[model samples]
Target: MSHPQAKTHRMSEFTESIGTVTFSGIPNEGFLALGMRNYWDGYFAGRAAPLGLAPAEVVHAVFYNFADGEVARHIPWVWGKTTPEEAIAVRERGSAAALRQMIGDLADSSGLARAADLATRAAVSAPIEGRALYAGLRALAVPEEPVARLWHAATLLREHRGDGHNIALAAHGIGGTEAHVLCALAHGMRPEEFGRIHHLPKPQLAAVIDGLRDRGLVNAAGGFTDTGRATRERIETLTDELAAPAYDVLSVAELDELIAGLEPICAAVDAAGD
Candidate 1:
């Protein structure tokens, strides 16, 4: 015969198990392991625990159980140092809810259903923002330079579409000065190379390259550095991650339709340049 309190505890555990899977992308198998670990840690320690488990033990269970490499890769950097005090501060600020709402909005605006679905799943845990804050904390742990560089490169490439002239035009158009355009172009080519392609004064081009190198966006060798490579990687990862969960939701025919829709705009832009 089961003890009534034990039975009640088991039911609660079951409910939480389902919640973790539905909301946090934590698989049910891992949930059970975490729940068991937490249960033992709390019971043995005789402490009133916020997570109903020892923090270290809970984190260990989570790391071991989650199979998705992305979450695992980020966890060490992002949540490795989250103390109870930090968690409390986050709760007080209400940043998490705001993040959840923002993610939802991004999903709708970007037509990324997978991201939207992930956001909705997260919403099940305290209105979505808290979850977002938790996620942000994890992201904070990752080294910033590599991620920032990857993002910068991705943004520039997206804007330039791999076209050198388009990059030149954009730098010139958006920068509001020849000097600024020249600086932006220095990102992708050597000083002599840029000079030959664009026919700018050699002294002026050298100055622009010097300034960019000082800013740490360009290297002395006139190529992307380690930081820049990491920046590009992070941007590509984010774009792919956001797009993956929604790919199955769209049919092959629909994707082709999207490609068809975009082709004319791309052609027009290219033709206009010509």
Candidate 2:
């Protein structure tokens, strides 16, 4: 089932790291414009519409993008003079504006063309499937520009993997709260960062931690115990296994090409940080 070019390496580890960073590092985007545009673009492209109501947008975005509480905490800092609800409302308006804005902004930004090409390279290997995760992402209208096309493709692949991850999380008996807690602990993110960004309650988080300790899944130092590490490993394995179809068509050589192309772009994006 594996692509001949796709050698057996740490595909799961790699995809996890790259996909997580690619999406998670949006805050470090060139500026508000870069950040918002990519956020909105992914928002718009990731789903199919009859776009839901404003409140619905809030619910979906908060669930997927940030911990709702995280949005609440950072609203004053990131968006300024805004509430979490207000921020969601702004995005709900019309993604068209986001698309229009990012297109122009991206044009002026340096090294986008190279990044776009890299995305395209990876995208070529992502085969289509009958599921909405694949179909909806493919449904997005590709822009004429190389950069926009590349961005959309990369977003598509990222979401495709994300859809699979959600399934993997559910199969392991982890709920939203525990899932967030585990991710924070395993990733070495500060509890404050995870709780605020994910909208998790401090008390609930403490309770989860206590429960995890009782199960020998976490330690007093907020790090994973041996069992906890094993659990994390299992979750990652399932996620990557689920995501394998996208890369199944890609040869090891092809995957290597994408990784090579991605390096410079990653550096460029990092350099554009605030």
Model 2, which residues run further than 4 Å from truth?
Answer: 1-134, 193-200
Query: Which residue pairs in candidate 1 collide?
Result: 77-141, 78-138, 96-129, 96-130, 97-129, 149-231, 150-230, 150-231, 150-232, 151-231
Model 2 weakest lDDT span, ten residues long? 45-54
> What TM-score would each prediction reach against the true structure?
0.24, 0.61
Per-residue alpha-carbon lDDT of model 1 for 29-136, expressed as tens digits? 222333323322212121112232234444433222122232333333323334333433332222222223223333133333332232222222211121222332
Work out how many backbone clashes candidate 1 has.
10
lDDT of each: 0.31, 0.51
- Which regions of candidate 1 fall more than 4 Å away from where they truly are? 1-187, 190-218, 243-249
Q: Compared with the true structure, what per-residue lDDT tens digits does model 2 show for residues 1-274?
A: 4643233224433333333333332322322342434453333222322122224434344245344353333332333333333333332222223332334455444455554555554555565553345554465445556544555555556656666666667677665566777888777885557743344567866877788788888888878899988887797777666666666555566666666655554444444432
